[model samples]
Target: MCSNVIRRMNEQQLIDGCKRNDRLAQKELYDKYSRKMMGVCMRYVNDRETARDILQEGFVKLFTNVDSYLQEGPFEAWMRKVFVNSALEYLRKMDILKEAVSLDQAPEASSSFHSVLTELSAQELLTMVQELPAGFRTVFNLFAIEGYSHKEIGEMLGITESTSRSQYTRARQLLQKRIGKIL
Candidate 1:
């Protein structure tokens, strides 16, 4: 039908339609970004079902706030930030970040761990990351994957920068230990 044909919009058109609360455009946008957004959610939560919830919640928030989008960056990047923040909100609600150990309790970083990581496939690496404790996984995903600084992660997660740094260090160490067994 011509209606369906008209619904196949480009990114900007989808954004415009979403801003106008167009259902077709919202569905199109969800279809386009859901998988990638789900991956982002999974990186933080690890559980598929919870990630699905976050993905849905992220879309809701994205649609609700689309009017505030400044159009200063790539639309996909903005979408990712929304999904990541949604995941962080879930984590905060669960109080998972409270499990983060202090910097004093963290182990020394292993330089050799860097070389082991280079050998892993992305899936392998992701699996190892998913195996981390919730606190460590959140910090690692934010700092390493999302490219946020510890200060920013701390501000977002309501943790201190040092706590974020320690959690990230511990995450790397745990991944290295896991990779050692696989190798």
Candidate 2:
């Protein structure tokens, strides 16, 4: 298919350039993937400043590990996995991400992220989330935004599932307050 051909060509160029340690190629790759990857970082980090730090760290890992990326499949998925691992690692360092999140029959997400979220600019949404306190925001973003199960959040954060759920509950409350203020 024409799409496959285009993807192959783009990846091939970037892969070859990466193999040669070309800084420009590295920058180009970062430019292309940073936004999505930052979204990953933000899910695990409660602070926008810390999220940016994690984003930068993830890009460094991507650039250095570019050679390790498999040539056979979807590049974005691979990049996402890398960013996710990096975000988890960052949470581990912070010690707060270890709280257990409880799912306990929470309601279904209010809306599909793609549809409900389209109404707000990315910055506005991020700002709304960033307003949440640290522990609450991290759990909320991981569960609500990134679609991680509460059990998964619990394992990642070193907390009980119930705690993750509680944090998520609190996060929702906080977001509601912030949204009300904005309105």
Candidate 3:
């Protein structure tokens, strides 16, 4: 199909075309989703270069594994999930998943995050999140920013739900401490 024709196609058809190895179709898909998917990748990875790397690899999976996508939801949203999972997987492979300071292992959760959060803008929050060590940071992003439940975060990172909760607590604690320092 022509580039214009490819661009006009809805995502499922674009995905269907990609499964058939249609170059124009895949390019169209990439052009459509890459920006938003990059945002998602950046949230998880917290580094532009690494997030871009994840975005490229995630797109590779999108093209190579297009057949695995279910016809269950919006295609862009599906692709977002794929890229999100892939970003998480990249963190896991890098051995960053186990750093969650278990609540039991961490000092008690403080009300510090709440005290300081209102003063920060969205970008400020993102920066604070980026400053967290990997385990605490990833869980915080998934649960707090991305809206994943503790159970989902646990499953994705291979930790318990309580661990996810505790890690989230610790992440907030760290954010509080760091932001407190900045103010």
Best candidate, TM-score: 1
C-alpha lDDT values of all predictions: 0.85, 0.72, 0.80
Per-residue CA lDDT of model 3 for 19-77, tens digit only, reads 99999888888888788888777777668999899999999988998888777787776
Query: Candidates 1 and 2: which is better by lDDT?
Result: 1
Which candidate should be chosen as best, given lDDT against the real structure? 1
- Per-residue alpha-carbon lDDT of candidate 1 for residues 2-45, written as tens digits (9 for 90 to 100): 96787657899999999999998898999888888988988888
- The lDDT, on a scale of 0 to 1, for candidate 3 is 0.80
lDDT digits (tens) for residues 96-181 of candidate 2? 55444245422333423444455668778777776665677777877887688999989877789998887888778656555544
* Runs in model 1 lying further than 4 Å from the true structure: 1-8, 101-119
- Cα deviation of 110, candidate 3, in Å: 6.0
Where in model 3 is the C-alpha error above 4 Å?
Answer: 1-6, 100-121
| Cα distance off (Å), candidate 3, residue 130 | 1.3
